[model samples]
Target: MVSAVLLAAGQARRMGQPKQLLPLDGKPMVWQVASAACGADLLEVVAVTGAAGEDVGLALADLPLRIIHNENWSNGQASTIRLAVQSLDTRAKAVLFLLADQPLVNKALINNLVKAYRESGASLVVPRWQNQRGNPTLFDLSRWRTELLQLTGDQGARGILAAHPQCIHYVDLPGPEILLDVDTPEEYWQMQQLWQQYKVTKG
Candidate 1:
């Protein structure tokens, strides 16, 4: 079975506020991502909180999922990833790593990744847009759990991907949502504008 890990522990130093709490269509950014993860065909969805643990928890209170708080969040993304990996269900065959700020991720993309992983049997599976790798990458626990446990610093799974290129499988998908993340105030504002346009177009 596949499990999803929503990483929501970043300090948001550039935006000067918790990006996870930022509103996207009247819901918290992390909530939107977690909601999608919950809707996906996965065995479990785990939300990892760090700097904004209390607020993030409150944001995702109603979601039927597991929440984990990482005390060593200041150590960087690696700590949050490790925390989620450790908290994952032992029955999980693979774990999907998701970012809280990527509000555009949806259940379809997640399901597609899982489908690819099941068929390809690759050690790692990730979405790629125009040759650029994106967020919400999946790793086979039986294959890479040891490597992931040894990771440190801000680098999430990039090191592992670099070290084992042959084992990586990319699922080509359209759109910049997989790569676009809200990091700074300007970027957040841009995302807000894009979201507004998207709503208008959809309606």
Candidate 2:
């Protein structure tokens, strides 16, 4: 079974507040992301929280997902990734990593990646937009579990990707949602503006 790990353990230092709790279309950023993950074709969804663990939990209280707190969140993203990966069920075949700040990643993108992974037999599945890779990358745990467990510091699977480029199967996708991430207050505001514009365009 494929499992998803939503990383929401960041301190959000640039935003001066927990970006996970910030409102996006009236829902907390993490909640929106988790909701999208829940809508995907996955066996389980796990949300990793840190500094704002309590509020993140509250925001996702209604969701049927597991919440895991990372005590080493200050050590950077790798720690949270390790925590999520280690906590995965033994039955899990592959795992998809999602970021809490990338609220635009919807169910379709995730399901598409899963479909590609199942059909291509690739150890790594990533989305590419205009030749640029994007987040919510899926890794076959049967191949990379040991390497992922040994990961340290903030690089967070980057070193693994660099070392195993041949294992990747990039899914060509449209739009910048694959790369759009909210890191600061200004970026969050910009995301809202862009979301509004997108809504108008879609309508």
Candidate 3:
């Protein structure tokens, strides 16, 4: 079964406050991400919280998820990732790693990724927009978990997977949603505007 891991342990140093707690369109950023991850098919959602663990936990209280605290979150992204991976259930065959700041990514995009992974037989699958790779990257648990656990720096699993280039599969993402991440107040506002525009266009 495919599982979703939401990485929410960042310090939000640049943003000056907890980015995950910041609301986008009336919902907390992390909550939005949790909803999308929970909506994926064959996925058990787990959220890794750090920085302001108490606040994040409160925000996520309504969601049904296994929350893992990254005590070493100040160590950087790699630390939180390792904590989350180590905490995953043994029954999971594949795990999709997603970022909390990506509130713009929706349920449909995550479902597409899980569906493609099941059908494509790829060891590592990432959503590709133009030439840039984006979030919600999936790693086949049977193959990549050990190597992923060995990762130490803040780069996450990209460098390890890149070493085995042939094993990577790129699914062309339908929109810029894959590339958008709200890191700052300005970016959040821009995303809100973009979301409104998108809703209007779709309607």
lDDT, candidates in the order shown:
0.91, 0.90, 0.84
lDDT by residue for model 3 (1-203), tens: 88889999888887899999988778898998898777768558889999999999889999888898988888878888788788888898899998998887778888888888889999888888888878889999899888878778678877866788788788897677657988778987888888788667657
* Candidates ranked by lDDT: 1, 2, 3
As a TM-score, model 3 comes out at 0.94
Q: Among all windows of ten consecutive residues in candidate 3, which has the lowest summed lDDT?
A: 194-203
Candidate 1 Cα misplacement greater than 4 A, ranges:
200-203
lDDT of 3: 0.84
Q: What shift in Å separates residue 19 of candidate 3 from its native position after superposition?
A: 0.7
In Å, residue 30's CA in model 2 sits off its true spot by 0.7
Candidate 3 colliding pairs: none
| Evaluation by lDDT, superior candidate among 1 and 3 | 1
Which pairs of residues have clashing backbones in candidate 1? Answer: none
Model 2's C-alpha root-mean-square deviation from the true structure amounts to 1.2
Pitting candidate 2 against candidate 3, the one with the higher lDDT is 2
Model 1: how far residue 44 lies from native, Å: 0.5
